[model samples]
Target: MKRTLVIGDIHGGLKALIQVLERAKVTTDDTLIFLGDYIDGWSESAQTIQYLIELSEKQECIFIKGNHDVWCEDYLRIGKANRTWLFHGGALTFEGYQQLSDEEKKKHLNFFERMKLYYVDDNNNLFIHAGYTSMKGPEQEFYKSNYNWDRTLWEMVLTMDKRVKKHSVLYPKRLKIYNEIYIGHTPTLYYNIETPMNAINVWNIDTGAAFTGKLTVLDVNTKQYWQSDNVNELYPNEKGRN
Candidate 1:
């Protein structure tokens, strides 16, 4: 059995992320799959992206595109547009970029553009930056739609039941695709539940890392979970609002 480490959203909390990786004892032999949101939120967005890119070159690392990443790509690709980029934690991400040189910034932006939206292993486990709603069809379609989708569409998909909704056409019946779908986004608290879902074979690992949540990781084969101590207490003012 291949040992894979699935990581949750890392919203620029470089210190916290480093601790989690160290705790996981990541080795050259193991695969590290990041679910995205590598930038924005804390103070190390640029650094985090650089580190991940470096790691990718050294080992097998899968990078997925988070909503924030999409915004970053847009902001860099287009001269200007929606301020939503700045409003939705882009300010922090921009701040992180300030710490880097012009050349470094260009390099990171190039990397962000090349990230994949989702990763599906032969074993059946699906990895996506965020959970999908019923509106999309087929895994590939979901990936394409999500890359350019707006929040309203995403919300609609999340609110409706995948089985009965027209959008659910894209997703294979839960049992047919794989036993579990590992996803990020839609903070766990939005579900107002403790202990993230493992039922329907869906495991949400986001853990609200940007707010009063801890960054998380789980071993695919063993299902062993690990988390960083809640760093929210240290940044009380930035919780939820960020």
Candidate 2:
């Protein structure tokens, strides 16, 4: 049977991405849903995007837009972003991007342009780069900006006591809207978790690949996951935004 694999924030860790794919034993028939943040941090942002472009050509892939990705896109189109983007990891992305040819830049920019803020699969599973609030489905159009930046939804999931029967009262009906929700952006490392974590109906797959953790890819149907070696190990000589 064909499988759907959801990937976490890559953050330009191209080596980590390759390792995770190898560990997952990905097949061309498998569907890959990337939770975005494909650039920033590591030194391989340009190569990472190019690889994803090639992967899409032969494999089923869905790319979701992440906040870092939005920053990169904005910088490419208008040459501007907030200081957070510039100081955090955007400078590294810019350096990597500068190494690309003009044609490569155009192609990568187009890929960013085509990315979605969120996606809902036939199984009613929501795949988003970040969280979503407004208690509405993806089609409801509550706040377009929040589609790639919201953290409240995932935060709510983290704080609610899943062991309690009354946990439903803590969140909106939207919390129950999907059979499962997979997201990246807020790294699991912030919660002291170094792997994919399940909270309520949400799965956080960002294992802080941009920082001290590894890249992660999870099979949506089986809940089986694969992880890369520590991202820092892949780029031993680089500071990687630290």
What tens-digit string does per-residue lDDT give for candidate 2 at 89-181? 988888877787877788888999999889999999999988877666766757887778888888888788767553457556777788899
Candidate 1 structure lDDT: 0.70
Q: What does candidate 1 score in Cα RMSD to the true structure?
A: 4.4
Q: Name model 1 segments beyond 4 Å from true.
A: 79-81, 133-137, 140-143, 147-175, 192-195, 233-242
The TM-score of predicted model 2 comes to 0.94
- Which candidate number has the best lDDT? 2
CA RMSD of all predictions: 4.4, 1.8
Sliding window of 10 residues with minimal summed lDDT for model 1? 148-157
TM-score of each: 0.81, 0.94
Each model's total of backbone clashes: 6, 0
